[model samples]
Target: MEQILDLETDRENQTAGPSGRMHLGGNDLTVDAGRVVLDGTVVGYLYENGFLRSAREQTEDDEDPDTGQWRLVDDLEGCDFQGTTQDGLPLSLPGPSSPGPTGSLSYNGRDYQVMQGRISNAQHKILGEYYGGGRFVLRDARTNTERRSLDEGSVINFSFAGTASDGRDLSEQYTRPLYRDQISYHENEIIRYFQDFDRLDQQQRDYVIESMRIWAASGILQIVRKKEGNAALGNVKHGAAGVTRVRTGMVDLDAEEFERDIDLCARFGPLAVITTRVPSYVEVRVNLVVSHEFGHQLQFCLSQAAQDRIDELYQARLARSIAKFPPPSAYDGGSELVHADQVMHREFISGYAKASVFEYWAESVAAFSFKESRKLLRQLDPGIFSILEQVVFTPEKVMSAVLCEQILNLQASLRFGGEFGKNLLD
Candidate 1:
């Protein structure tokens, strides 16, 4: 049976658990621990090893009795239990509630996979009792596991100088080569996204502003204008609408060229403006360009599994390309896609996608996030849509979800901090 989660629920009573019963995998679920409040009106669960963790786990000094790998921490005081599975599925534990020996989250008539809690923290506002061993953790919203691997460092800003540093120490960077007009345009665009600032929490708001700060600091966002009479109408160092590096995050946008393309799109059609095979049913040119570049930036923020999955898919596509577009063969052609086998062109969003896995990912992410274009992309390529829905966009990819949460958190943050918003190659 295809399980559909109820998104619209009563916010006040919305955090209730097994109070209303539900079944998963043909099994019965019950509410053992009652509802407790977290800050910001968030409520959480406290169930035994039913779905989240094993009852046999440890809870002593810095040891997650369940895994015994990392030090099981017991500082659950006023902390949100955000976590995810290793493969990028999200799991929720009860709380701002204290930890207990056994715990799990029961939501919408379903038991979300979560770590059973032990109250090691002090007290709740209403339920004044000592809680056990729930540790402070950064979590993936959808998938849950007892522990996370400490391979990729925490998601902080990357130094434009190719070094990584804890937030406290890094020197600030600037948006390179942006002229007065360009800078204002960017600041205005940044502010446009920030217009909904009140909708976000302090953290989300901080993230948006800080993310911009990092991009600006990284010496990225180099902008150039193609003059009206410049004969080279379509000159790009990298083939697509814009280009950026996997690590450097350097991005170059042809504002004049793009403006020219938009004008052409109006005169001839949107098809004349876009490089991808995706049909021009709407404004897919300029918007898609910005979204696409953002997609590349988003790629740097994802967790290992999410990144791996992106690489895996791109490699699969690349493997086929290597076969079809044999080196220096009869198919060697001038245009990016002319050399591609029929299958390559058919599967990708645009002809630009055929150039590289990075390009394909960037194009798809742009298509996905850009609302007006999403409908056509889904219709044209359902398979790609499914992968994006199930993997990259899942709330369980913790690092990835962090981006979403901050974006969502902007609401709370605005009243409180502030905000946000893909990609890969094999």
Candidate 2:
């Protein structure tokens, strides 16, 4: 037999029991007007067809509670709430929730993994205090171990055994060896030596080390310095001119040289070389040039299929730029062309990106290293962002957690105090 209940009339005429509480399915529900009150607090409201819209949970510290945390119970039967807590932790009702009264919690820029409602640090050393009712007691300072661990593997191991492709060991040529005994992590060794490496100050050297760590850790053949180069700050190339020689099987050379080159087609990586007496600029430009050259290194190291995808994306972006702003006839000089390129490719990170597909990619990589440019890159071309995230930023590719952390920290730092990429093209 089918029984139909008149929900509208029932709700309008619904009244509380003598004690101001109504009994519904063994639960005491207080019906005050159209609201369902639980223990003198309004939990939800009765709607048409006897449906109850559950009220959203509120945080004690939220200024706008209504917009902060909300859960929607779409159906009266077999419905659950799914939303985030006030602390931005994921919240799901009914069973097996996150932070489960004894789990990790990230609050106010610190991580706490608690057991039995007690908070602990990374080394699992308990602070001997319980975090009751969502209250946290943060440590005054991080331990030295914790601080050092942040950049543990950021320094690459370099072996000065084999001679550079230039037929001489640049390390011996330079009087002052800047990074002779600075081995940090136990990853694969790359043959690297700098010429005139001591010219830069400590801060400049630190920036160079941090910026180049990701590429060096990802199997780049070498990091060599050349005393003479064509006015360029840095460049990446295949075998014979840079740090390590890579056998691409395209050119036939002597068996001895071929034996030395690594044979993995995907791993036939390029060598990165900077001028011997490279001038130090602002930190932003220093990081940008190194990372940009490594961007070319990354292109050579990638598989053919991955390279094809990048080419496809570049062509698509180029078409969009051409469509947006057609090229003008006559230009005064390079400045006019640069200005026109900036307006034409407003979606790109910089005007230099309009040079060519390779330049576009290199410029994108350089910009993606900084905080402000990364945000703008995501906004402008999420395709490039997704591609870079998959290929360059993964732990499997980078192979060092410390190097990954260094890249993250470099990305977090703002260039020019957030006025970055405003009028600058480089």
Candidate 3:
């Protein structure tokens, strides 16, 4: 029981009478002037002159009628075509040569022939297609579908070569090559990760930056993650002098003296900002510390207040402890010498001088800039106020009268304009 479907056989010359001929499954079929053979089974026995026909189910009109066409349920309800072969096979339909369905594709340096027609239905494409050529149809190996085209060279390379149900020698050409794009998906994933990072709003970014500052001050500074570690970083320094130094440790400072400590150490441009590790943490507090350090730098950059303050503190210690320091330079500016009854001698002496006279003046400026900052810390934690009070005012001292007035004037001008003194303090 071998069923053979031959191409080039005429329909009138064919004979089907269930005698001395191989029994093809589902009735004897033919194709393109060739004898058709469905080498499967024949169960349902309904015959006219021992030649039989089986009805096929019908499908929706939108489907490919050739593939979608089906017989009525009643037509095949009791039909049991005998099983001629366990393997599914197709046979040629008796008629003039007609294309089964044709498509051409090239892969792996070889051309292929696809027998299944291009899928016109969207669903079929989603599920994929099959391959066909010669006398039979086979599954498309490239996309793993029934409606796929195969190039002979590609098919052999992909390992697909055999006879289809139609008894036609299939050329490996019907199978498409498995082509994969490696870079596209990888690039997409990278972009997606960056987008996820970007999706974080401003508040989240700020929180992260704040945490970094805390860790840095707490002596935990190190490269947690360097995006471009080997790239040259511009030269910058954190010392009082312009010298490069890499930091690797933390320092403990009285949370009270955070601003004071940072101010004493910071210098403008090329100087590192000062910060200290504290046990209790708050993003706002760390932000205040950074503001204070930069405040020192801004003051130094703008005026001579820093040098002046340093001189004053030094002279105070000299007068009390050693008593041989030279007297401060004479008040050289044309400003009037105005002294208050409660002002310290140092204040009177310094205030009578011009605005541009001393180095400590920069410290005064930084202190002025940090007033609101100090208040913010106090609002967050009141204990920080005592630290501020100790540095600026005490039982044995008063700030230089001129420095104090300058600070007050700077505040007034900023808050209420240059004509601020015209109004009473509210």
Candidate 4:
């Protein structure tokens, strides 16, 4: 673990960590002229948030041969921090001022190197200067001033999780990426934008983060800028924005993937009714892909021992439920998975859930994690809802206790019971 160096908290002279110095307090950490100061050093600058809107890094001398313009660096914030207009078109702002970003990024076999860069609002380009094999420095993109940088100590991989999903503990399966992706962001405009977002009405932005950070922690969603496309692909190709591997907790949601589906997800409103673009026979595919993928990761992290017990519990519960109420003698024999409004909906959240026990558990797990999805599941089948609540979630804790706790918290706002009980709350 990188020791959090503090002037008062530490006994010895401290060394800067990969993130350098950090000023952390809940809503009290103020920014002046875009920098965060801790102890006496300016750690990192802040970005201003506003309406937004992409591009590359260039040096002072690096010029576009054809256009005769410097190759403009991608304003990571402008591409990231966005909003929508009253007419519902994308609104890209150019105001938030920021120093740079701190999180690590993984890419195709190599981590991008971090380097000192210049950001100029005048030229609209970030000029990074990285030496061949020496240490890197970061600078304010606007003023061309070198800023302090933090060094990371270690990237911890989980050690004790009982065992692996397969036969043995596949501890060696996922090797943490050592290489770093070197990039910088514009400071002045982006920093100003971020500092002002809390003051602006959320509806003003294209996406308001009421619970996005909390929600995304499920699989540790890390969006990377590898390539741009309408679909997401990594670890394997899925024509979607996000992919979660059962073997490893590493998840990737392409920026384009979120961009493509968010509007559709919003269309369902309050309910966020899922509608799929997968061209399947099922009438709709919910925008619960994030929730769905999180389910897969949670289940994947479980040891074989834990999985066996979960299956045993589900089977026993299935037998009891079948005795109380029989399955339809006539099978719908549908090709794609489906969710219906009728009760006793074939002991599955949807036709998709019926494909297999794993799929059934995953679909219900999503319902277990989300609000609108859970509502739909309960309306479709109370028994299955109970099953998801008890069997799967109970086992899920063995893998990710924190994630399960979050789901529990997220669902706390909802109330449910029998018909009269439901009316009582309303």
Best by lDDT: 2
Model 4, 311-368: lDDT tens per residue?
6655664564455434344435321323344233344454455444565555566555
For candidate 3, lDDT tens digit of each residue in 1-426? Answer: 111221111122232211122224334432211122344433221111111323222223412213434221112323223221111222221101222333433322223333232111211111112344322222322222222222231122122244443556554442222322232211222222122324445543332233223212211111111110111112222222101112322211223343333333332221122221321211111222322223233222222443354445535533432132222245333222322322222221222112222312222222223333334334432322332232222201223233333333222211111111212111
Off by over 4 Å in 4: 1-236, 239-249, 253-260, 269-284, 303-306, 309-346, 378-426
- Across residues 1-426, which tens digit of lDDT does each residue of candidate 1 receive? 010111122123322222222222343334223222223221223222222221223223312224432222233322233333223333243433334333332211112222233212111111111122112233222223232221111112111111111222222222223222332322433433333435645644443343333222121211101101111212343334323343434344444544544444345532223333322211123234444555565555556666777667667766665565433433333223433234324445654655565676667765665344456567756655665554333434423554544332221111110111122110
lDDT for model 1: 0.34
> What lDDT would each prediction earn against the true structure?
0.34, 0.37, 0.26, 0.32
TM-scores, all candidates, are 0.37, 0.35, 0.17, 0.32
- Candidate 2 lDDT over residue span 57-119, tens digit each: 434332221243422222223543333322233323221321223444433223544443334
Comparing candidate 2 with candidate 3, which one achieves the higher lDDT? 2
Better of 3 and 4 by TM-score: 4
Query: Over the full model, what C-alpha lDDT does candidate 3 score relative to the true structure?
Result: 0.26
